[model samples]
Target: MLSTLAMSVPADSNWINFDVPALIQNFWSATFDGLTFGAIYALVALGYTLVYGVLNLINFAHSEVFIVGCYGVFFTLSFLGFGPSVPNLDFWSIVLNLVLALVVAMVASALTAFVVERVAYKPLRKRNAPRLVFLITAIGVSFSIQYLIFLWRGPNPEVALTMFRPTPIFDVFGTIIDSQQLVIVLAAVVMMVFTDQFISRSRTGRGIRAVAQDPDTATLMGVNKERIIITTFIIGGLLAGAAALFYVMRIPSGVQYSGGFVLGVKAFAAAVLGGIGNVRGALLGGLLLGLIGNYGQILLGSSQWTDVVAFVVLVLVLLVRPEGILGTSLGRSKA
Candidate 1:
């Protein structure tokens, strides 16, 4: 074409070129960031997946539950006056603070879950309401939780500049893998392991499994459906709360409503991708989604369309496998 158009072309007519090296560098950066973000999403996704596994209902309010946990950490740290000042202490003291904050958040979120289950879901389940009814109730609970946070914080963002900061273990190349990421990853992993063990080994966990498999039969067999559902919510809530702590650490300043809505939506997508009612699927789905979103940005040098990419992937996956990566037609089953 160049030769053919030489008569019309001036000195040069060539193909467009871009900075390949820069693109490669950005891709790697995006990949790393995606992995970290994916880890966080996985933690949040666990809540959705776990509850869905047992109850067959998505806890829409789990997002706000996580935000509440974030607020719990923020307020606790605020009262301790640990902002912007590195408390000169031994490694053990720092570890203590971290553990305490994480525990508090987890406990608070678990309680929130319990309360929500009792007030919003249990009654309906007892009456044998349709799943759509539960869906509406979940949405109401989610918005109510957000409003309650707004009432407490009055639409202000929590910004702990230096306080409750995670100790950075080291740097990979130039990217800083701070203590916060480690905290989120470790806490989430521990909770996930505990949950897996509980469901697989413990008595109550067995009851929950029995309920999921066949609620009527399980009830006939002496399994208390209410107790199992409440337990599932508590576990899911605890994980969300822990995820909130690490999430806020990364984005220290954000509106209260932001976490529940945006992150919640993403985590739900992860849950569906991994197989909504499968715990392991949720983890894998969240990680995969996060990685794809982050790396896509690096490749394109923009995140303006990240949501589009996410939805597109969702659509493609659904088209290919409507039941998700690990989904089945056996109805609701234990993960």
Candidate 2:
């Protein structure tokens, strides 16, 4: 009876005894993976937040815009004879190819955004149509763009160009952090800084804010509301383009019609969680979401829990702070 009672007392009475090194490893891995994904999601979230700040309408097709960016870069690099490894390009040539791919993707994404606004939203805005019409239009536009990719690229996936050389960054604790991750992190930071400066300190930024605050008043003040709207889309699209490059760098797979949807939704969720329309909020929200998502999986010891963690965190944030952590109107009026 005494031996049975002692045995029933529990072999591990403390949670702290569950292997500290493994926990730390899991934490870092989760954090690194989350941040990498969050970086891309932050870019996409900026698009949703910015558009919402100005138009108050979600651009459902924005995900497809990101897919276009990935495809654009992939196709451009492939055309230049670069793949998992390029045999004979000098350093400068490699740099040039990368720059050109980035540029082309950005330009293509910007153009796509412009066309979407012109064909879909412009008519709706002009006719003073119901908001639901805009929503429907956005959904329709999203499907149309997705199907366009399907028709053009087909059911097959294309792989992007990746440098074959292994680097030192991956040597940390058996968790390989690719060189692409470094490049991605740096590029994302630079772009975010530029975006912040543009939005806060530039004349065009002021115009965007004015339009966002009140389009009618902005037009009355000669703010060129049309131009501001176009600029907004361009900015959003450019970020999406950048995100595409990072995404493909990490995954190096072909773009799919629905590939961008998950990212789009996650980014949109990040934006909302961080207080939509607030630039700083988007950043914070993205990082927080990423860290939570990655770490949650580690703690739970299952990859299947990743999506669940993200949604659970989002729901909790919504319930706790409906206004979000930063709680700012950004440029829009509060309801």
Candidate 3:
């Protein structure tokens, strides 16, 4: 898209607007907004990290997994009697609705992840397909899932009714941190922390790491590779689903069949920026990417430049540190 824009736009002075003043003025707002988006990115990145750490595959279809979760969220909210307008529910009722939405989304996405694994990936694994074959299959699966949703829901985006009205939670410097942002950020942090602990401290986590480090040896030692792979995909799905819920909360009108592409790209970039297989790296990369993209949009005075800026920054980082911000792979980490 950036390339197409650059090619189509005239070589006039107005094409690339540079607005340092706007950037300076909106610094705090952008920072807070970036963190909200970064939180979403980090959750999605966790999905990418787990799959890549174990299978050494990008799992591009994970984006579709997220969108599936979005559908689940939409249905759950609709079933709860929430409409396009804000509901007049008491606080506890509202909380219950949100909790239900989150759970349904997670389960939906996780189930999709499991099915995709069994239907699309397991055969390739059994056949001992090459890395390129797996990559192609992943892309194919992504498209298949996307178009399937397209056929089911059509091309138009569904605007899920407002589940909660955003009220001011607190003030950070000059920025008024709202309830929606607070919830999304807090939820993402809690999920990431739990995932980190699970990966680091649990027996299943050790099995995952053992497989990632040396699959054959791990398998020989009684670690079930199939079960671990399934677990990894499910974990990724859970995170992606949570990200989907937060995304819908932030942008109630953003749900659609193809909506996951841009988000998946950003999440994948976050994973790569933070060190693809590292736990902490995804979080750090996501936050930084969000800040950079948001800042670029302000500075350039065009939202179109956001992704271009993020990718440019990613390239620069890779040039400086090829292994990403946190250079440790999950399999090899001692702590």
Candidate 4:
């Protein structure tokens, strides 16, 4: 069945076609799609930034955190009796299901992240292991989670039933805005703002900042390093979970064990593009990457090249400004 579907997808004969007028005609729609996806990337990028900001270690398993959240939402909705065959749901039903899915995904991702930190990282921290050790552990944890899911769920992608049909809400400059795009973009912005404010204004945020600045000084100042580290992982997981829901909403084909790898890589690149340790930089990098990739794909007339386009942008950015658009040196993030 999968092979049949794959074969059924029309090949792009115009892969190299660069039609300026056609691109101009589809500009708004592509931009909207890009921004929506960019929001998801930004949300995932936060996980990278938050963990790196405090621990100075890249949690490569963070991608699995996102994959777990995707499965969480899928299972939650499935339990609610929403599968691929279900018809359109009522308004309140859709809302309730979405809210429940979001909560479940967040909790599941957070717990997964916490476990990864405890089992894979804490021991190394105690031994004061080198950065290479941490990197290997992260990759190991990521693969473990991926295969574990594969063993449990098999290699099939889990598809969700369409709960909310995207309807045109309005039109702008010959571009029709759909419900899904609006919800995704708005929700991402809200979550990003809340996270930024939480990190900047809250007491715990101050402690995280303090630890990021100087761990020994923070410990001497009575800040609980372990607690701060755990909190950062949890927060990162929460954002990844939110992004998972948004991702499924935008592309409901299904969730697979390996689904998060590429998107996670892109999100990581976005973190680097914006300045890895800077929170606001993640947001900027995500949106910018999204726009550039989308435009590039449209111009080139091939969706398969989107990832290539994004990486090319990343390379270009690194070559030009290694600090990222908003990134500063380590321990000097504006957050």
Task: Tell me the lDDT of candidate 1.
Answer: 0.75
Sort the predicted structures by lDDT, highest score first. 3, 4, 2, 1
**Is candidate 2 or 3 superior in TM-score?**
3
Q: Estimate TM-scores for all models.
A: 0.86, 0.88, 0.95, 0.93
lDDT of 2: 0.79
Taking every candidate in turn, the Cα RMSD to the unseen true structure, in Å, is 6.0, 5.7, 4.0, 4.6
Best by TM-score: 3
Better-scoring candidate (lDDT), 1 or 4: 4
Clashes of 1: 0
Report backbone clashes per prediction. Answer: 0, 1, 0, 0
> Which model scores highest in lDDT?
3
Better of 2 and 4 by TM-score: 4
Where does model 4 exceed 4 Å of error? 1-17, 85-88, 329-331
lDDT of each: 0.75, 0.79, 0.91, 0.87
Q: State the lDDT of candidate 3 residue by residue for 1-335, as single tens digits.
A: 45445545546766786677678778988998999999999999989988999999999999999999988899999888988898999999988998999999999999999999999999999999999999999999999999999999999998667988899988877789998888888989998989998999999999999999999999999999999999999999999999989999998877899999899999999999999989889999998899999999988877889999999999999999999999748899753
- Per-residue error (Å), model 1, residue 200: 1.9
Tell me which residue pairs clash in candidate 3. Answer: none
Error of 1 at 21 (Å): 4.8
Residue-wise lDDT of candidate 1 within 164-194, one digit each (tens)? 4465677776666666666666766677677
